[model samples]
Target: MGLGIRALIMVFMTIFTLTSVANAAEGTATFYTPPYVPSSCYGYQNNGVMIAAASDAIWGNRAACGRSYRVRCTGATNQGVPQPCKGTSVVVKIVDYCPAGCQGTIDLSQEAFSAIANPDAGKIKIEYTQV
Candidate 1:
């Protein structure tokens, strides 16, 4: 192929690769459970909530948990003194996922949980928005 043609092809290929990678990272988030005792034992009701998961490498694993773009959990503990019963919203990145059929709500690092709601509530509904 001519030099110019080859250069154009390379550029197109690069763009296509980047587009595919971006699309693969995109995902949708939704509510999983409600606040209750035995915080770790709960089931998600489909269509309960909707959130966004931006272009990230975290979604590559089905059993990853950590700081994600956002996390919505119902059974959050309020942080600090004077705890209250309130929902929790956290911005976390997924480091690993829960085991298959594992009970409890989405796991999050203590740091992420403190960012949105208190840590004393111990169990509250949560809704997070992707940033």
Candidate 2:
């Protein structure tokens, strides 16, 4: 191949690689919660913490909550895919606090928890990019 043509191809390849790297740096977080309020009064609402059990199949009975997270959703796993989280982004306020030894990352509300996790699965993977 001609020197000029080879040089042009190299330039284009470099640009494409750089752009992909930049996009991968972006990140988000997500969680799954119960669909409706539980019959038992075992839930709490702290200053920013919210915890509730799922009435549906996704997270039935098993407790899942969070203290703080960036994003939450109930969608397919996007582990390798870039920016998999999608749906309403809710701002959680810490009204109360969870005691020691809480299982999950954050104690989320019924609505917040349900967004990213299947009640049956009871757990959702979260991703975030540090600012």
Instruction: Please write out the lDDT profile of model 1 over residues 18-116, one tens digit for every residue.
Output: 865454322223222322222221223221122222222343444232234555554333344353323554555443344444222444444454454
Instruction: Report lDDT (Cα) of residue 44, candidate 2.
Output: 36
The candidate that wins on lDDT is 2
Whose TM-score is greatest here? 2
Error of 2 at 37 (Å): 12
- Each candidate structure's TM-score, on Cα atoms with residue i matched to residue i, is 0.34, 0.35
Instruction: Let me know the TM-score candidate 2 reaches against the reference structure.
Output: 0.35
* Clash count, predicted structure 1: 28
